[model samples]
Target: MSGFARSVVVGGSGAVGGMFAELLREAGSRTLVVDLVPPRERRDAFLCGDVTAPGPELAAALRDADLVLLAVHEEVALEAVAPVTRLLRRGALLADTLSVRTAMAAELAARAPGVQHVGLNPMFAPAAGMTGRPVAAVVTRDGPGVAALLRLVENGGGRPVRLSAEEHDRTVAATQALTHAAILSFGLALARLGVDAGTLKETAPPPHQVLLALLARVLGGSPEVYGDIQRSNPRAASARRALAEALGSFAEAAGDGPDPAEGLDGVFEELRRFMGPELTASQDHCQELFRTEHRTDHEGEKDR
Candidate 1:
């Protein structure tokens, strides 16, 4: 099949859901949005209803759809799968935008064994657009519908990376869960120290400024989304524990060791070894970012 002829987004009012809905529409799919509330952009076909207690209208829509994408919370998605999949015709695709996929995969297997499904997680914010960004695709049951969805992502300039459900969860634990925890921990320390934002902005070095940028990103978004990333993934706790242990090691090295300088050097060396060849490339990339930031700041001063 070229692509899905009819697509339905269960929570098309939300960011992730809305993104998919727009993409599907642009691909010439007869897109229908079914949600508790209306989406920001009005669509020709829309159904206002809960997927958990799907009404006859909603059931008819689901049954007719070639693809049904769930963009709701983990609990809601899990709860709706049985009912939603029951309505979906065999060979129809069941997909989700959930960060954690292991549970969703299991749910689909148990609830709808014959349904062709995939678990997708957009690595970046929906507002950023899919262009040149990584979009994880966990094909639970591969079929024509799954291929169609992957093509849609690619056509929209997204990099659809194929991964298993468990693999996706493990990798994201490091990329999302651990990374967010580190940035948030830094923000928490700044707050605990009662550091004035203006003062920090004035005197903070490039690394501090970089961290502040990350802090801004985390703080600006919905806490519920970030919390789901941390809580839903089984591997997240292990990743966070690793972060805690590393911090303790650094503290012990500097404060408890006989020779602080030597201890710090050893820790740094170990880290560098762990990072391997990619560390140099990362350092160079970071330096380029710092240079760009410096140029922007200098230009602002010139304007002033």
Candidate 2:
């Protein structure tokens, strides 16, 4: 039998929250969803409550939960933890789906020292589902509840990569924050150049098309979520600064000078050495993606 019989998911109306609610119900755990917005699925018991301004009804419900999972924004989770954790039983597990974990980990340690807790961050978009996707797990307090929840993630085809909260935040700063910044910078540059993206679509090379795709994906998604990713992670600023500095160096290397190509080559060689053996595999993967993108675009055109 699973340790979690009755699970509570805060912010169960959102994509990530709803995904967890569905997964828990499918796993036979009685799930109670609490959110301002009503979730689309009625499989789980729903409660309209605000965790930031939780009432007695919410506190009472938290007391009975075997596992309480927060799938809310980082700030909201931080605001809710103090009130929510106070109501939980000593053995109850508290878990969160936050992109940045260092603050949440600290909050849980301070407010819910006795309660079992973990932080889960799905690396992929919730709409994509969990299959073959990596979910970063930061285990704050180890217990049966934690194990069962991790097992639940694994059973749902999510790969759980255990990481310390600090490590998780730092790694995502480079991986998510820096990457998004670069793509956004590219989009900004295009705007500055007065280049119409639609006009370039047919003529753009694969690399440019890929950047356009990335830019579209980021711009198409919720600005609040992207903003949170950029703002919540403290180390993101450093990553952005590094990117800016690298671009500056590249610009200087490309400038009119004696042996500019030599300077560029030297920089490329250093980068190649830094990437090491992974460079070959990454290039191969990129080529595969380019082919897939090209094929997909053609198929879409044929449909029209």
Candidate 3:
């Protein structure tokens, strides 16, 4: 697809929104950013306005915009759909960078009527760029607009996975919610045991260190964003419950204590079977990762 002539990002001040704005600009689109707060870096291209209310600035931005990207929070994204739909130029493409798609997709379909819209969830952080990354594209209404937006993602080196809003939400519940819950649970366990960061760093094994690093990475992000992922996804609660159940089973197995090895072996075999062909690949990847880490450590020691 040919590049869009003009594009507007509704929440362009945000990380995800800003990243896409930059990507669009790099792709030769005249990109306009609309947000309540001006972007920290690119103040020049931003129009300060509330998208839900549809002010003159937003109307002007949408007047000639060939593409409109909603990169706001889930609730705000849903709210903006109706007003944004009203002002969009005929044949314009509307898309969102929301993590949870089911409710937002439904809201868009109900509120936007004939407007062409798509739901996009970049599986990695914007800072990571799109190279070799998986991006979920939910086609609420398929048209030239949807094709064009997906082409843009492909141009940026993203691997676009097509999914319905319902499918996307269900998959995210397991991939995102369950994983996050596990990490957060680990962090909570550490806190309960009163383990400080310095102590953990000094004493932890490689696997524990890796887990700690993951927990830190998650905690470093916005609480609101993580909260939304945990709270907004309808399947999140059940996923958490499943994790708790697994933990309880582990505890029960440990308490049985008369040769817990056999039980653990059974669990290990089950997981190995579940991983199938990926098990060897995952092990090799982890070994290489450890080698890299050790090399970095040795280099740092020499420098010191």
Give lDDT tens digits, candidate 3, residues 1-304: 2368999988899889998888788888899999989899983388888888887767878878999999998778888888888888899999999888888767876887688888889999988888999999998888988898889888889989999888998999999999999999999999999768898899766677778889999999988878888998999999999999888777756666555656666677778999999998987777666656555452222211
Q: What lDDT, from 0 to 1, does candidate 1 have? A: 0.88
Q: Which residues of candidate 2, in runs, are more than 4 Å off?
A: 256-261, 295-304
Count of clashing residue pairs in every prediction: 0, 0, 0
Q: How far is 107's C-alpha from truth in model 2 (Å)?
A: 1.7
* Model 3 residue pairs with clashes: none
Choose the strongest candidate by lDDT.
1
Give TM-scores for every candidate, taking all chains together and pairing residue i with residue i.
Answer: 0.91, 0.91, 0.88
Worst 10 residues of 3 by lDDT: 295-304
lDDT, residue 259, candidate 3? 53
RMSD of each: 3.8, 4.1, 4.3
Q: What clash pairs does model 1 have?
A: none
Q: Write the per-residue lDDT of candidate 1 for residues 1-304, one digit (tens) a residue.
A: 2288988998999889999998998888999998888987796378899999898998898999899999998899999998998888878999999989889888888888788888889999998989999999999999988998999999999999999999999999999999999999999999999879989989977778889999998999889878988988999999999999999888888887555767788887898999999998987777677778776442232211
Cα error, residue 148 of model 2, in Å, equals 1.1
Candidate 2 overall lDDT versus native: 0.87
User: Worst 10-residue stretch by lDDT in candidate 2?
Assistant: 295-304
